[model samples]
Target chain A: MSAADAIAVAGVTKVFGSGNGQVAAVDDITVSIRKNEFFTLLGPSGCGKTTLLRLIAGFEFPTSGAIWLDGADVSDTPPFRRPINTVFQNYALFPHMTVEENIGFGLKMLNRPKAEIAERVAAMLKLVRMEALAGRRTNQISGGQQQRVALARALAPAPKVLLLDEPLSALDYKLRKEMQIELKRLQAETGITFIFVTHDQEEALTMSDRIAVMAAGRILQVGSPREVYDAPADRFVAGFIGESNLLPGTVERVSGGLASVTLSVGGRIEAVAPDGFSGGGPATVVLRPEHARLMPAAGAPEGAIAGTLATAVYFGTDTHYHVRLADGSDFTVREQNRPSVEARFHAGDAVAAVVEPRAARLLRERP
Target chain B: MARPFDVRRQRGFTVVAAFCFALLYLPIVVLVTYAFNAGESIANWEGVSLRWFVAAAGNAQVIDASIRSLQIATAAALIATTAATLAALATTRTAPYRGQAATFAALNLPLMVPEIVTAVALLIVFARIKMATGYTGLGYLIAAHTAFCIPFAYLPIRARLDGMDLNLERAAADLYATPVRAFRHVTLPLLWPGILAGFMLAFVISLDDVVITEFVKSGGQETLPTYMLGQLRRVITPEMNAISTAFLALSIVVVTVFFLVSRKRD
Candidate 1:
């Protein structure tokens, strides 16, 4: 690892209960995060992403393995002594304290001088644009303001790593989007590592430098948003990262990096296999919705699968056509709504679905 | 807070509520008003005077008893409230423990049992201790009071503890505070009002207790209530009524203050 590696977890495991009741909440997992990176854990609820974050934060102890922060083993350290902070899901502002006081509590715990605490709190409040509401009781503020206060309080302490557990999940749509950009800007300004947890894939893709996509208490893939979206490693990741049509199939032929597979439904398709898939075997092909082209029967080309448009959804920027192919496979294609005749597609019309061979991914079928 | 004139139903409710209030307050009101009676008779109406108040003030035994009661009740409330706070914290904050309900029921056993039973059980235990070490300390009364008052203090505090948001403490820990620091800074401040109310309730309960105090107290260790009870056996005096009236007023004041404090928090 380089000097820029801020947090490293190796073979971490967490089990709840004992003996007959034992259930593993987090299976053995390993990850490394670089300094000043806004990394996100993207998974559905109950996927152990939050558990992994808590283990890193020292809020929950790992049942096995080690966690390192800034090259020091901090697995056994308590939360307070660790150079990490978190913004809780509910924003957890101290109801008894004013906004200024709530933001100043961590500094107070450091036993900083009163004047210094005041100065730092003032700067933090101004950064969050909450200086005007600093004197108000925390419960008296609006949810968005409280959210800012929670962020300000966490950031004011100058932690090396900040964990945000679904911080924007409680906010309304507009505020959540606004906070996402604000958080990105704040991370840019402070140059601190942020490990945010969320189930929203779009939010993760939009705000994070890298993302660890998790499911069933295990990490499925870790990569940049574009990398994960365009080149998912497995069916779970492909199905998760973006909308995709997965066609389970058996591998019939394999070349250097490409594979021609016979789908389960009696259709031959080509896919780009991940490295190290050697030969003939049962496999699955994944295709992104936008990768497939929908053309009317008159303009259709050879090698195109025939289908009828089941539904056409108009989404301002793009129109998605859901086509049910001859093999009974439902495929969706998103066409940009440019001012052209080709942009118009209607449900119940016969069309041809064409996807370039390289646009699809092939994965070995799981038991 | 006003009801725009409901003729019949409102009057009926008003009369019924007024009757209940009268039933609650009549004795105490009469006692306070006539505590200044100039005559010595207990049953006759007489002009008021400050004689009994003066007498009550000058009596060394009554003053000593009052001081002792205050000390014991304060100690008991402090001890009980502190223990109850810890119990509340463990049950609310930590990961759920097995048989938590059983633990809660056991802690709350004292409230369900009769006060006489607790008084006798304490007396027997104290007797054994005294026989073993020959110490007739008043510490036993404080201990008994603390044990009996635990349930009264625990219930309200535990309710507040349950209602308190755990997210605040998580936020504190996330902000790099140790668990103890989070409890001190975040949990305690949010829980203070409930703690105060619980303490005050335990204090009042300990002070007004007569049966338990009579059973556990040794000869010559007279609390104010016990002293008044002793007087009641021989002759009923308006002077006893005056002391009772004072105790009643104190209870009302503490309860009212508790309500105001909790309301202001809301």
Candidate 2:
């Protein structure tokens, strides 16, 4: 355990129900969040990301482990006893209170002086840029304004940690984009630990300093957005973070921290192998859509996979090429639509797909 | 260019609705109209006059009974609503346990059984208490009304508590509010309208209760309804109609307020 960590979830498992009906909502997860880090838990529905956030927020107690906040074991404590606050999925603002009052609520609950409450509330209002709407009821404000108010209210308490549960899912697209930038700025300005939970990979990739990708109540990978995206730890992480083409292959050899794999689709490619060496077995090669290119078979690089160009569709910013590899599986490739990045190969042409040396990764298939 | 589904267009629909309204309001309408009759006879209206209203007001028994009714209603409504609020929070706020359904059924027992049966049961139970204590006061009547009005106070409050977002309570707790403080600051204010509506319902229910009051009350404890019953047995006059009209108006006013207060905003 590091002293710099703001929170540590040590082998926590939260189980719901009893006896035969039991199901673990958070299954044996142990992770540490650094102080002032914008940490995100990204997963699909029923992945227990929200449940883990609740465990950190002290709403749900772990079935078999402890939660440490600032060097204190707080798993047995109630939510009110902890110094953490949450921005709920629905905002959960007091409907009867005005925006100013909602923001001042946590301060008032802490029995801060009335003058201090007013000053802090004013500062928060300006921080979220809701000074003009201070007197308005929370229901009276627009959705985006309500989101800002939720942020201001959660941050006004200067909590040691803030837990956000899909706070932007209710907002429209434009507002969500705006709030993503606003949230990062707030986290930086406040310098408080923010543990956010969402299923949207792009949101997590864009706003998070580090992300824990979860599935089926188990965290699959934890790394920076780029680390988890460009060099995913395994099959699930690679598929979830972005578009990936997983091709079956056998590991040929491991040398110089890279493994060359012989593809079943009639080619061989080199990939930066994962940690730990001296292994030779069946492995899958991960090729990212944006990392590959299409060219005529005659001009292709050595050992490049030869394929037939099946379809090329323009997507404004990029063109998507669906080429059928030798085994007749679709080998998808995406190219940026810059002037020099025009699609030269059309459908029904003999083409070869070239993968950059760094773009491929070897995942050893579990026996 | 399709027609909307209108119930009126169906055969016998308008007839059935009109018949229902007519049956429900026809008696009250007849009584209200006769309350303004100038003559002493309730069956014949001589002309429009304020004589019956004035006579009813001037009668000392009517005034005494009216005052007693108001006092009992206020006390019963306040106590019943308080008890019902606590009961509602207890039942709905916590996780369900064994016997929770039975508790709910018991709370609403007075409404299910016939009023006469409840009155008779109370009569039997109170007879023993009275004989043992040798006490006869309005306390018994108030106690009976309170018991009967509890379910009246409970339904609206329980519905409101059910419809409320439970996350608001969690949010309050996350903001460092103690359980009591969360209820005081967040839960209570949102539940205020429901409490008010429940109180009004309990007030109206207790104000006009007859069978229980008849069985439970001691001597000189005649509320307006019981007093009217006594007058009906003695003589038939427009004064009774005036009192009934006033009672009907009071109920309508309270129920209207209850309806307005219980309207959900969100």
Candidate 2 lDDT, B81-125, residue by residue in tens: 999999999999887877999999999998998999989998999
Q: How does each model score on TM-score?
A: 0.91, 0.94
Clashing pairs in 1: B36-B49
Cα lDDT tens digits for candidate 1, B1-266? 97687765654788888899999988767778778788776667788787777777787878888888998899999999999999888888888889999989998998889888978888888889888998777887898899988888998899998898877777787776777888888888778888988899899999988888888887788999899878889977677766766677778898899889888875
Cα displacement (angstroms), candidate 2, residue A130, comes to 0.7
Docking class of 1: medium
- Please write out the lDDT profile of model 1 over residues A1-367, one tens digit for every residue: 4688999988989998999988788889888999999999999999999899889888799999899999999999988889898888888788888999989988998888999999999999989999899899988889999989999999998999988999998899999999999999999988999999999999999999999999988888899999899889887888887899887778888887889887675456778878888778777788898888777867776656678899988888898888887777788888778875455667788887778758988865555
TM-score of chain B of 2: 0.93
Q: Which structure among the candidates has the greatest lDDT?
A: 2
In candidate 2 the C-alpha lDDT for residue A144 amounts to 91
Q: Candidate 1: TM-score?
A: 0.91
CA-lDDT, candidates in order: 0.86, 0.91
